[model samples]
Target: MTSLKLIFSLFIISFYSCSYVYAADLKKLAIEEFKKANYPKAIEILEHALIENNDDLELYYCLGYFTHYLCYDSVPLTGFDIRKSDEVLAYLGKAVELKPSYGDAYYFIGAEYGVRARRHLGKGEVDRAVFEFRLAREKGGLPDWLIEYGRNNLKTCDRDAILFTGGDADTNPIEYLQLVENYRRDVTVIPIALLNRPWFVQMIKYGIENAINAAPISWSREQIHDMHPYKWKTNLILIAVPETIKAELQIDKDFEWELEPDFEGRLSAGAAVLADIVKTNQWARSIYFSVACHPGMYHGLGDFFQSCGTTYRLIPTQTKDTELELDIKCIEDVFMDGDNYKSIASVADNNMPRASHMLNNYRAALFRLLIHYYKDKNKRRAKEVLDFMESTIREEYVASGALGEHLASYRKLLE
Candidate 1:
């Protein structure tokens, strides 16, 4: 009996060991397919692996991740389709069940919820959207600093302004602030990435006309859908390019350029829609771009960009110098309040690359403010800016990099 028991235990141990090894090998193969952007195949391999090694935590997580991309890719208009969310969530939920402390799993789960919330919002399901936003806040584990970042960005704009935001980090938090907290419902938040889709643009037009009663976008749905980039020949101007934009671009009778498809030869639906807004609205309402936006999103209007705290307001007045035109009063109004600077600087250190990028943006802005004060010969304000930088930002962020060198050089200048 003892011999039989020993043999059976050995057999059980060997089976599990072989299973683990097989699962690991399958994981490797799946990852390779994922790297090649063959998301469906990657998901297939993982799904099969999970049958043999049901408890593999990474396997479940990867399955969730890959399914998310596949769902996003398969969607035609916008990538916020919630139909496959259940399957993705199930895999992530299992991963979390396997390891309750799995932070990445929790983050992805929250992200999925957030995306679903956006989809609901797009579909005009406000109640469902709010519920999903709440779920995202509860499950996403977004830091307080991010919420504050969103608040600060909103503060940068005037009441009833249109704010164009970019990417998940900048856009999601602002949406949360508006939909969930009811903080800045007056300001219309438009995601540039989604503006390419007719449905999203129509939703924005409806919301602007009905909810906010802002200046109506003149383009019909069909017009917006039909819009594409075209070359700028004087006789063949498809749409009337704003004189301000024309002057900014130095377009004369002899000048020729293209709008719509950017220099990369990729048509930018967002740019097309934005141009229409600018033309139709004629600055009836304020338009600001979050500083988090890529420069390309400015759509050749960089010359008119005036830095106002956390965003750049597009003014008609052209700037001659390429240097950033700072709204000094606005910057002081936003950042100089008691504890606000500290709060801005107090973003918790994390390994998240996005969070780190945001931190760098904040730091760079602060540095620009410091330089502005220094150039103005306002020693008191300059010293205050320097003190804020030293006191608030983590040392690790500035300990030994190019930022550190810049800070060291500035400190010597201040001394």
Candidate 2:
């Protein structure tokens, strides 16, 4: 027993001597410093720790984060650019490999991918931007603030497609009719409220069976069915009604409207399983966002235009007499050219908790004000505001995925 205790004590002493010896502790201290915004001291310690132990994944990621923050700050003579995009990429790559299920590492890497996308953009690499953003969404952690921001901004065209709300009580009928039309175009609408029902489940199964037993050109129906039971069943149902129209349209597949109960979850899951679907498949980009209803005239139009470009002219002016009619028309214009009004960062920067609130109060306020400025046909103020947004987004901010790095401050406007 005495010998065993002596050996254990020796092992403990050796472990302590060989490891940290104050180095790992110092590395951790550096991370805390970085978190507290004392980057200079953090960098000093990180450099010390890295010299002693360069293979540490957390150390690399923290260093990468530090470098990224420095790049963002653009301190004079700080040589940071999208070229160093790979530095973060490499560090994150190792971090992820060292800890496969590390959510924080994934999140950081995803964020790095977003930055990579921006770098690619700066270097005129559209394909790379697309690739990085898709990967960011896949590996990036849950829908946290950073992820949501990147997702929303990076794929504005797609996500902006699905409008969540539309039409007042009076316009409900027309909207419902339109919804029916959309359903007809894609049969998933057939299931409607029955998506969650057992009957639909049976229908999907029957569809699968029928699809399988239909037989090939030369094979007997019985032979075909015998040869490929599962494949036939799965393929047939997949052709019926895919959950996202974008998915259905791209793969020539249909939805299992039966899957509506967990549609968003399915999107996230689909993003995971068919991770390459975004790059390889055109349909993945069809509807970037999947909200319930279509926004009417004054819908997401402003946001869309702000993010994209304003090549198209306004829908020809209409002589509407009533205020509600004017509002409805304006709303439609908002949806059609939503991208025109302001940079998404401008709209999103305010620390608003809920999008609904932003829509109701903040966004609405901006729209009213901008419209008011442009109402008297004050093209000059409109031009000035639009110019500021375009310049800010173009020169300052570099959005990677859904995550946008604000390059400049809009705070000056408030002042």
Candidate 3:
């Protein structure tokens, strides 16, 4: 018994020592990410740090601050995302509770309320906003950046249960739709590459099926392989993981699931299972891949998706041709274009990648419409599509060489 006690004590000491050693490094990494305008990544790092040592007040405060930047301060506020808003409060409140004298925490609380006020005032709902601003001023005057955030933010867009499998770039549109417009709430998001782990798959399986707090799955790797999504009958396949994990998997030919010859690059065990989930579930739900999704997924899915805006939505009957009318409308109005896009996309240097990516996808969709009409021998509609595509591409992505080539080539083909 004495020996057992000694071993347990040594284990505890080792754990604490390791956490203490890594805590400072974690904090430093999060700060660097913050400087790079990678708010989500920064928060993710600190969240792990808190797990290492939950008692770290500064970590809590930093977590709260970066989360605010992610949701409100960094971009032009578009929606009242309760999930994020409540999350901000939970972290900030924990910080405040941990250290009542943490004036910055108080300031953040107030600024968040001020953002709420700004949203309210936009709709001519003045009283609540005033109260929130007053609360903010009581803690600290609104920082210049926070003031700018609320000033530029306004409500926009609409959608129904649109879920994203990738990063902020892919998710922001639906976030605005659901939060600002209070549109749809049934969206389910599974973070990138989470499907790569056997444990994560089991978590997804049980967590989703049970609708409860998911404990880490203890299944062996073989167990994970056998637990295909086809068995689950889930709706939709969202391929968001990059190619890194894809190199590790093999498609089971005996399984009757065929990824395209040249296009099916590779799939991790978890990703292959996820694809099967969409396939075995009767192909009823839409499978959308973000621009970041491996090309293998895009091509291997083999004409299953109708490229719509930034996402390639799984369509049963055809490709982009059928969705041209509705999707073109979505592109023009909704696919992050025009002055609003320019302003929001300009705020952070890092944001440009996703913005350009989204614009590129929309451009490709438009070009597809042109080709669809041209092939149909519908000269009038074809010409109309060509005109719209040319003008919009030039307006949004003036510097895209590929887009320029597409315009020149497609124009020749149309004629």
Q: Count clashing residue pairs in model 1.
A: 1
- Strongest candidate by lDDT: 1
TM-score order of candidates, top first: 1, 3, 2
Residue 203: error of model 3 in Å? 5.9
Candidate 2, overall lDDT?
0.38
What lDDT would each prediction earn against the true structure? 0.71, 0.38, 0.52
Tens-digit lDDT track for model 2 on 114-195? 4555345335455665566666546542223332232222222322122112211111111222221221111111112211
Candidates arranged by lDDT, highest first: 1, 3, 2
- Assess the local accuracy of residue 33 in candidate 3 as a C-alpha lDDT between 0 and 100: 94
Clashing pairs in 3: 79-180, 117-129, 229-277, 230-277
Give one digit per residue, the lDDT tens place, for model 3 in 259-336: 432313434455555454555434323345554455654434535554555555544433333442234554445533
Q: What 10-residue stretch in candidate 1 is worst by lDDT?
A: 232-241
Find the 10 residues in a row with the least total lDDT in model 3: 148-157
How far residue 409's Cα lies from its native spot in candidate 2, in Å, is: 40
